[model samples]
Structure formats: structure tokens, C-alpha cells
Target: MTSSTDLRKAFAPTGKLRASINLGNPILANKNPQTGEPFGVSIDLARAFAERLGVDIELVVFDAAGKSVEAVRGEQADIGFFAIDPLRGEGIAFTSPYVLIEGSYLVPEKSPIHSNEEVDRQGIRVTVGKGSAYDLFLTRELKLAEIVRAPTSPTVVDVFVEQMLEVAAGVKQQLEADMNRFSGYRLLPGRFMVIQQAMGTPKSRGSDASTYLAKFVEEMKASGFVAEALHRHGIQGASVAPAA
Candidate 1:
């Protein structure tokens, strides 16, 4: 039977890993504003996988999170580091979620946002990235806030920077990067959507290879190692629970 080593050695992901790292999203994927170095959760996961398999990982840029998924489908990336969703699972294999993630609201400094009640109290303009998971969730869950959809992730960032306001995204690292820049970022007391996050492997892999890697990922999750890695990387906001 081919082991993880054998599969990776045989199919070492070729090409510059089209790293779909968004520009402003901090914890997931973003080039450092100061050093021009890409440092984030996605980078960490990709680096770990490459090291484990004795391969190399070269990062290429993707403008947004959704584009990252496209990169994998187009054979530009071996994988992308971000939350694995059921919709995405349709054509992919994902590692067991390392951290418990949730979607919440982040507003500008002292914006009279006292509770989830204010989600609709008055002129609450919830700006969101186009085609983002948070946009989908807000569409389904939010009743009162006016959803101001930005054309892209960067557009969303620009909107928030301009208004000093916007709703918090439910995604990880992205939220940390988006909301943490200002002094007034808060988790919005008791208001967030539960979003379980996992890593993704593209659908292009053969069924045999996919199943084998899935089992391997399950084992890693069971070992409680991914949690340690997440915490080590300054992404402590993700709730780390023992492997199920």
C-alpha cells in the first residue's frame, strides 16, 4: 500500500503553489505589511505538509479566498489553508478541523453596538466581501442590517477603512486581520455563528489516493497536534478542542 510518503513523493504538487492569500486577511493568508513576507495560518499548514513530505512549497498570490479554491481546481495549488465547508467538500477532501471556528460581528470603535440586538436597531450597514462565506451567512441569518456587498475582499477592506465601520466576518484570520487594525474591534457580546473549519485537498486526486489521505488526516486530528500548531502561530481565537 502506498503511504503518505509514497503518494506525496509520487505526486509532489508541481508549479508555484498558487497561494490564494488575501491581502488584508491576517491570520489565514497575507503578506506581512512591513517585511513583504507571507505569514499566516495557510502558510503554516502548507509549510508543514511540504516539510512532512520532504517537498518544497513556493507561494503564488491569489486576490481573494474564493480565488484560492479556484487555484486548486486549476492545478495551480496543491492545497489552500482555510476553513473546509460542506459545499467545498463536494469536490474535495479535507482534514479534520483543527480549531472550532465561528462567525461574529466586528464593528468600528464605539459604534453603539451593545448587543446582537443592534444588528438591526438602525442604520447598520454590514459591508461584506463579494462571494465570501460570510456574505452567504449574512444573507441567511441577518434580518435587519443592510448588506453592502463589496466587489471583492480588498474592496470590503477599503469600505471598512473608509467608513470606520462594517460587520464582522465569521471567517478566521480574515476577521483578525480586518477588525484588529482599529482600536475598537470587539467580538460583539454573545453573537457569532458557529463555523467548523478544516483544510482542503482538491477533487482531482484519484479516489484511492483521496481516501488514503483522508484517513491520514483523521489520524493527525486524533493526535491533537493541529491544535498545538494553531496556537503556536498566534491564532488563539480559534477554539481548540481535543480531536473527536
Candidate 2:
């Protein structure tokens, strides 16, 4: 069995818990408008986990999910929140998801592509955030349609509009918000995927640390901590994941 001291050593070797936060996923995290600080469901969870380990917390923030995942995979940060993908699992040991978010596609209101299936046809170009979960998933799934990647998730729609791409793929809430920013766009009814948002530490942390983190996630869901945090953050279109 892994003792509490061993768990601390694995999680906070630098004497503080370093959490890699991605502001790209609006449902998980966002920046404070007035203070320029990180605050959201992911931030709240990071703080709570640090408190559980009885350590001070440090946020290693990034504007893109890929950068955040790299920080944890390279062990530059102790842990991070991410959408579960098999590619990322090579370096990171992920917990059962604590939040479930929808991934959807957006297109011009008059686009001939009315359904998710229609967007994959030849000559239809899609834009997604580089190194994002949807990007990874679509890379494997889309055979005929070309994928154009934006520098970050927040810019997916921007790139789509700027480049006149046929489709934009990203977090459903983000796509919905982008609809407001860029007129003449509509989301395909239903989702293309369900992104499993979870916490992860480097696989180097060992099975014990991974197991502990998994338990923590399950507890957060059962205790309604995850649900309350989402509500407090004013996030919509995401739900607490069921217990694992």
C-alpha cells in the first residue's frame, strides 16, 4: 500500500502541488476578467486536491490543452486536467473522468453540410484546435475531409472563418459561443463525440499515485463537488461524470 507520505512524494516532489491548467477549455477553466487569474471548475479541483495532500498549490497555466498535457507528460508540472485520448495515455495516467462535455461541429448557416456525416465528404475542410482532443479524435476518424488546425482551441472558429473552411470542430459550448461572435453559423444537431474530462499525472508517478487520483475523482463526483463547481463557474452544457 502507498502511504500518505509516499503519495505526497509522488504528487508534490517539488514541495508544492503543481497543476497544469488549460484555459482553452471554457467548460473546465477560464481567466478572471478583472484580475487575470485562473478560475473555473478545473482550478477549483486542483486547489481541492492540493489541500487534500496538505501542500501549497502552484498553477502552471496555458492557453491550449496540448501545452498543458505536454507539461504533465514532460513532468514539468505534477498534474493536469485533460480530455482522455489514447495518444495522451502513452505518457499520462488518467483518472476516470469527472466531467463530460460534448464535441460538436459548426458550419455556415447556409452550408450544404447539414449533418455530422455530411461534413466528412471530400472537398469539405474542417478546422480544429491543434493538439486538442477533438483534433486527435478526428485525425483518426476523418478519412476524406481535410483538417486545418488553429494554434489554439479558442481560435478554431477564427481559423475556420478566416480560411473559409467548411466546418469547425470543438467543445460544443465553445462552438455555441463562437456562433454569437461570428454570425451565420449553426451547430450540427447532436454531438460528434463526448469528451471525457479527467485529471492526470505522469505515468512515472506509478500505479499507486494513479490509483489515488482515480479515487479522488470518484469522491469528487459522489460528493457533488464537481457539480457544484460547474454551477459556481456558470458553466453550461457540461455535466458531472458518473462514478467510475
Candidate 3:
């Protein structure tokens, strides 16, 4: 168990816990259109962690996960919310995921790609967010399909439409919203992958911090704080991750 002093020393080295939040992922965070302030599950989790550490919280907001990850890597933020990926693990220590998000494909309504299995074929172009977990996973897993990376995840659908790509790979909820806003777009029946969303700190922060965060995540899941945050924020299509 991490002592309270150790938790504070690791999580708030600069006298406050700076949490890097990614606004690009709407499922984890939602920006208030009028106020431009972010409020969602990720924010709530960050706040709760800060409270646990008895430290002030500072939100370092970013438009994308790449930026958020960069902040943690650079030690610009003490911690960040990220998808649990081996590639990102090199620089950051991650806890078991507190939420599970589905990664799926979006295609034109009249497109012949009726099943997820049909996606990996010759000459099929799939657009994904550059450096995103889906991009990293598909880069290794995709057998035949060519992956085209957009500037970011939030922009993948737009890039797919503009480039006339065969498929758009991204968060299922984002694609569902796009299907409603744009005409003649449909999501594939099931998810291609499940993204494990977790909190991470710089590995250089030391093992004590990692252990504390991992335990904290399990506590939040067991206590229903994660589920309550999702319900309070009106987020759907996601569930609290199973205990580690």
C-alpha cells in the first residue's frame, strides 16, 4: 500500500496534481459549447483522485489523446486519461481501465461492406485518427486493408467523407452521432475492438505512484463512482470496466 505521503510526493510533485484531459474523445469528455469548459467522467475521475491525495487539481486540457499523452510524457502533467496501449505504456504507467469503449467502423449506407469481416480486403481504405489506440492496434492487426490516418480521432469521419475512404474507424458513439448528423452513414453491427480507458502517470514518477493509481481505479470501480459519473453525464454505450 502507498502511504499518503508517498501518494502526495508522486502525484503532486509540483504542489498540485495536473491532470491532462483530452477533449477530442467525447465519450470521456464533453465540452460545453457555450462556456467551452470541459465536464465529463474523465474530469470527475481526475477531481476525485486529487481529493484523495489532498491536493489541488489543475486541468491541462488538450484537443486530442496524442497531445494528452505528450503532456504526460513530457512531465507537463502529473497524470492523464488514456487508452491502455502497449505503445503508450513505454512512457506512462497505466492502471486497469475504469471504462470500456467500443471501437467500430462507419461506412456509407450504400456501401457493399455489410460485415466487419469484409473490411480487410484489397484496395479498401480505412481512415483512422493518427497515433490513436485504434490506429496503433489496426496498424499491426490489419491484414489487407490500407490505413489512412487523419489528423485526429475527432476528425476521422470528416476526412473519410472528404477523401471518399471505404471505412472510418473510431469510437462507436462518435460514429453513431455522425450517422445521425450526416446522411446515409451506418455503423457496422459490432465492435472491432474494445478500448480500455484508464489513467496514467509518467513512469518516471516511480512505482509507488503506479501502485496507488491502480488501487485507486479498482476502488472507484467497486464503489460505483465511475458508473455514477457516466449516468450523471448522460454518457451511454460504455460501462465501468471489470475489477482488475
Best by lDDT: 2
The per-model lDDT (C-alpha) reads 0.61, 0.94, 0.92
- Backbone collisions counted per model: 2, 0, 0
**Which sections of candidate 2 miss by over 4 Å?**
none
Instruction: Kindly report which residue stretches of model 3 are placed more than 4 angstroms away from their true locations once superposed.
Output: 1-3
lDDT of 2 by residue, 25-143 (tens): 99998898999999999999999999999999999999999999999999999999999999999889999999999999999988998889888889989999999999999999999
Could you tell me the TM-score of candidate 1? 0.74
Candidate 2 lDDT for residue 67: 97
C-alpha RMSD between model 3 and the true structure? 1.2
Candidate 3 lDDT, tens digit per residue, 68-180? 99999999999999999988988899999999999999999899999999999999999999888899999999999999999988899989999999999999998888776
Q: Can you list the residue pairs that collide in candidate 1?
A: 103-170, 106-168
Q: On residues 1-244, what C-alpha lDDT tens digit does candidate 1 reach at each position?
A: 3676556743365623333454434445557679888876557656766666666677766656676666665656666554555555666666666556656666766667767667764567887776566676677777767888776755675576677555654454455556556555665766456655556666676666556545645655666656666666666566653464
- Ten consecutive residues with minimal summed lDDT in candidate 1? 15-24
Clashes of 1: 2
Per-model TM values vs. the true structure: 0.74, 0.98, 0.97
On lDDT, the stronger of 2 and 3 is 2
lDDT of 3 at 76: 98
